[model samples]
Target: MRFAIISVTKEGQKLASDMELVLRNDPTVIKVDLFHKNVKDTVSNLFNDYDCWVAIMATGIMVRIICPIIKSKLKDPAVLVVAENKKHVISLLSGHMGGGNKFSIKIAGVIGAVPVITTATDLNGKMGIDALANQYWFDVKQPQLIKAVNQLIAENGKVDLHLPSRFRFLENHPLVTRSYCIHIWEKSFIRASLPGKEFENELDLYPKRIVAGLGSKKGVAGEQVFFAIRSALQHLHLPLERLDALATVDLKKDEEGIIDAASKSDLPLEIVTLNEISDFKHVDCTPSKLVQREFGVQGVSEPVSLIRAGESSRLILKKTAYNGVTVAIAVSTN
Candidate 1:
């Protein structure tokens, strides 16, 4: 996450320059611009080109001007307010859910101030590292096994790459041709990786970021389902390897044959509830009157998958046995 930190300070006080050294530890705070006592640039410029804004200032009035500026933008970056005294840090808005929240906490932690983390999920430490990894365009080698996430907190803890952190380290340089974490996966996104022994057959998960959804009627042909999935993805202009996991309604328990297929393919199954499926659907589609009333069309047809672009969905079943089915495959909706 790129940031433009504005420190409202007085002339000849050298607070802004002194503050720069304090914030430099956070790499996510890619850049910081100082606004001395006199600069008239509105805080809106922070949203003009950056992912978020960090305000390290003293007066509530200074913080007030920034609020309206952020209110005007449709795509708002995370906003954070802290005191120059390094005494307190408060996430007035967009703490975690917003793009700027995590950075705000880091800045607070570094300046020797308590991070006023208001996000309930974060305060409890139940925050999803996978989600964070995804947001930063980074990958997790062992997501489930990640004991704790090592975040680069900027305030007091120096943002040192070698610092003991739970998050795997990353450096900005040439695009990682070989597997690397934290990046937006474009359709033209190409990557290189040594074949995981598990995927020795095709090594399909070279750059995994997609999730697949399956929708099969009582008995649709597998060939039709596969072709339908393929054709649907091609129609959507998505790639095959981006698949991260397989999704379906809980109707298909662990006994569900499709579950076994995903296991064979090394894709984990993410069985969602009827409500969760509906929340992700792109449109209010009705698959069948009976099923629609019971579950959203996405649960019935599996169409809500949208992790990122350049990814797709597939149904794994016996190609020989035909089962009438429809599948929706795509990336997570971050």
Candidate 2:
């Protein structure tokens, strides 16, 4: 997550610089840019580039500049406004989904300022559905359900939470143990669980635990590669949303088909060198003689997946060929 800090006054600029240094300690923040002039144009250019915007300017000025470009809570970047003297930190836009409300408090803690969070969910001290989804890297399948779930929480109502048995931390978490929530499984549902009768407010979170390795001919079509990967995942009973990333041999670094497939899935493509693939001793999958002769490695997908994952990684699906593409799936040890 990148943060863009915009300031006009000397005090605000100094505060912005100090905040940038303070936020650099967080591993999640990759970059932070400071914009001292051309506030509107700079924000306009950087709106889509950064994850959040920290404007050390008046709230009215922020509103006039940001309102015209504001799309929605889901699509917009988190916007925060700080006073020149750093007395107040205000979440001006994208409170829940964009993480503005939560980040405002973080900035306030560093600057010894009051965080003004106006969101109803935060006001009621109820966990927002979008915040929960963001915490787990879970893509909201049905975004409309977020409103229903948040509304239920805000109304002092209970909603059932379903998670894998292994996630005992979340099951016993302070946030999850609140009176407005209950834990339930697919197989167990008591009559009193839905005391509010809010059947439409369930939130489902899926874990992205699968890493897919891809290999394909140079000129193969993207659709074919995608079809092959999707088919393999379907055969293995793995949801596409659970795919964490895509791995491929470095030789396919410029391959259009594999790139297209990964782009369509919105997964990061981890390219491995030939030496890494050939020397991978963790995985023992079948090797192809033709591939070995041409690519300097007996196999591409399995070794690449194993390299991306550590030595303890487990191969969930062996290399499966479809048309001119090959894909393999692995579960990371961690």
Clashing residue pairs, backbone N/CA/C < 3 A, model 2:
none
- Cα RMSD of all models vs. native, in order, equals 17.8, 13.5
Task: Give the backbone clash total of model 1.
Answer: 28
> lDDT tens string, model 1, 104-126?
55666666677776644454443
* True-structure lDDT of candidate 1: 0.45
TM-scores for every predicted model: 0.37, 0.60
TM-score of 1: 0.37
Best by TM-score: 2
In terms of lDDT, model 2 sits at 0.75
